[model samples]
Structures are given as C-alpha cells and as structure tokens.
Target: MMRSACALAACWWLPLSVPAAASPASAAEVLPPVIDVAGSIGIVTDYRFRGISLSDTHPSVQGSIVATHRSGAYAGISAYTLNGFGELGGSNLELDLYAGYRHNIGPVTVDAGLLYYAYPGSSGGSYEFIESYASLSARIGPATAKLSAAYSPPQDGLNGNGNLYLAGEVALPIRSTPATLRGRLGRSSGDTPLTPGGLYHEWLVGADYELGQVTLGAAITGTDIAAAEARAAGARPRDTRPTLSLTAALRF
Candidate 1:
C-alpha cells in the first residue's frame, strides 16, 4: 500500500512538470548570476570629512557605485567635489576606490576593507594615500552599534607620515516611522592633515528620513580643534565650528 501511494503521488505531479517542459520559453530559460549592483547620488550643504569641511563650507556634489558578490566581497568607487584646499594640493576632485568583504558571525557582523584616496589634476603636489579599516557591528534592541578603526601606513603622499582614526556609532530606527537617528564619536591621531596638532575628537548627530527612493538628512557636526590650532593649520572657519548641514540623496 505504501508503494502504491508513492506511485500515485508521482503521477499526480506529472501534469505540472509536463506543462513546464513542453513550453519552449521555460525549457530554454536561463537565470542570471547572483551579483547585486547599487548606487547613490547626493548633494550636501558641505562636504564634511571627519568633521572638517573639505568643500570649504560650500555645497558639493557626490556619487558612488558598488557591486557585491554572493560570497560577501564587494568593490566600489566614490567621487566628490572639493574646494582645492592647500593640504589637498589644491585639488578640486576627490575619488576613492575601495574593496571589502563582510560576513555575519552569530549576531555580530564583521567588515574589513582597503581604501585608496586619489586626487586627480592637482596643481601643487601629490595628495593620494591608502588605508585599511575594520569594523564590528551588532544590533541591540532598536539600535545598531558599531566600532571601527582605520590606519594609514607611512607614505609619501602624507609627507612620510601616517594616521589612525577610531570611531563608535549608533543608529536607531524610530518605531513605525521612516526616520532613523544616528550619532558618532570619533578620535583621530597620528599625522593626518585634519589633526595636525596631535589628536582631536569629532562628533556628529543626525537623522535621516526615507521617502521612496530619496533620503533627506540633517546633522550637526563639530570637532575639538582650537581656533589657534586651526588658524596655524590653515583650517577654514567651518572646520572646528559646530555647523549644521542638510542633504538629499537618491538610491538606485
């Protein structure tokens, strides 16, 4: 009786299989590989990097594209307009190339990557460097917390000096809403341009609201660099002053 029931079950499914096999389109259909590509373009009131305005306190345009593989490896490129700061060798364009891998272990996610900063068409000097970074993040209740570190080895572009940056971030999604609140505290040391006077702390508090394919954001960002230090370093007024920024971005 068990054998008879098994045969009947196979027979009952035969008609469904026959229709799919008989259709030429279904028989010859091919599925694409599982790579995902995503990108975003945006405009910000100021191009802030580590709490310093790279765009000289002016509006800047930026965009990025990334492609990810099924095995957790990804590569991306980002480009933005800058204000031709002296430290950047008066370069107006900044391009970043990066690649990384990310994977989840238990409830925590780990990400590690290498990034290259390139300044094309600079009139004064070479302003390019590379850095390696790693981060670990986990979700707690309604928020996600992350800790990250980035280190650049001694290189010619950095005047034979290097830099280190460590930061912690938290992002919380407002319940039943499309808004998310985010904050970060970071410390920079070594011999980076932004921290010319030893090490300084930077902080940011922001919120993002998603509207279909667009996201709107507002944030207050500042640094602990003193006015005298900023003046000696040739930093602009927006560098150490607490400033507000508004941004709009579209993702595809």
Candidate 2:
C-alpha cells in the first residue's frame, strides 16, 4: 500500500501543477485562496490509482493547499481524497497525501517533502508509506526548468514502488491562439507497473488554452510500463498504455 502511494505522488509531480502545490495564503501580495484554486484542484477526466482507473470505480478527487510568506519560505500539500476502483475482494478505495516546502535563494529554488498514501476502507490498519525528495528550479527565457529526485524504500511489498525521476518542461504563449503550450519529457529509474524489473521511459505533451476568464488544458502521457526486462522475466499480460487528463480554471 505504501508503495502505491509513492508511485501515485510521482504521477502528480509529473504533469500536474509544477512547483508541487503551495498554499493559498502564501500567494504574492496577500493573495486569496482563490489565487491558488486552480493549482489546488486537478479534475482528472481519468484518475488512475495504482495503475488502474479510478474515474470508473470512484470519482477520484485530488487537491492541494499552499501557503507562502514574504520571507521566501513556502509550504503546500497535495492529496487524493477518493478512489473509484474496486479491489480484489470488491473493496472501495481511500485517500492519499503529499506535502512539502520550498526555500528560495535568489533565482534558484529548492523543495523537499514527504508523501503519504492511505487505504480508506481497511479501517486504516497500517496501509501507508512515505516518500522523500529534493528538487530545484530555475528560470530560462520563457520557460522554468526543474530537476527533482525522490525515493522510498518498499513497504511490506504490497502496493507499488519506484525511484529517481528526471523531468523538465517549457511553458510559453502562442501569439495567435490565446493559449499556452507546455511541453514535458522525463527519464525515470526504479519500479513501475510496466517495468517490473527495470526503469521506464515516459513523456508528456500537452497544451493549455486560456480565453477570457476560463482556462482549458489537456495532456497525453505515454509510458513503457512493461519494459524488455519485465517480459524476459515472465510478466503476464503486458501493459503499455496512454493516460489523458484535462483541467479548467477560473480566475477572479
């Protein structure tokens, strides 16, 4: 179960909200929670939990709370409050949490924190785990480049588990379309649903368009879950798939 939580957090970090969800109070110039509202909610058209679809089993909801101060110190958190998928014995799903802090040094910023994955229906009987990580971000032209590495040792070997992640994205405006295109790519090591014995290769290509008062965004992510090593190791029913997500935000 703990292993699953760690894997889930990795998904959020990948293409969700960059900077990993900060607090609303921490916004610049005494901003309101509404300022971080978009960052706080990811209405996944398909929220997959533990390599399975939750939008089908449970209307999975993921959100975050962020607080930032003038002193350059900020804290925020992200979590999954429900799952729509059914377990082996037809059990309901639960919630998961990930929170961290960021320290700023001029143009360079650093982040560190832990993630908790919980199994809801089981009376909360020790089905959780923690993932720790460090990340850095810097601005270059019209894009913000970020680098992060996180780790978590296996927990009772039940859920899902993994290792290091190298991911980056570039966000900029398209002069003609009232929209923004954010391109992302990543190389990851450790364990994944597709790669049982080795690391996996993944990439995300998505776009967000803002017109007038509403923001619309869509992304398609592809991953090699069952790598060559997994097949060689007698893995069953190869699982290589694509994940899609869409989000909307209203700014006041």
Best by the lDDT measure: 1
TM-score of candidate 1 relative to the true fold: 0.83
lDDT score for residue 158 of model 1: 64
Residue pairs with backbone overlap in model 1: none
Candidate lDDT values, in order: 0.70, 0.50
Off by over 4 Å in 1: 1-32, 84-91, 238-252
Candidate 1 per-residue C-alpha lDDT over 139-220 given as tens digits, one digit per residue, 9 for 90 to 100: 9998999999888888866668788889999999999999999999988887655464768788889888888877788888
Q: What TM-score, computed on C-alpha atoms, does each candidate reach?
A: 0.83, 0.62
- lDDT (Cα, tens digit) per residue for candidate 2, span 127-229: 4555676778777776667776666655532245545556665667677777777766655566543234556555666677765544566666555655565
Badly placed stretches (over 4 Å) of model 2 are 1-39, 48-60, 72-77, 81-85, 88-94, 123-127, 157-162, 176-178, 191-195, 211-214, 227-252
Each prediction's total of clashing residue pairs, residues at least 3 apart in sequence or on different chains, is 0, 13
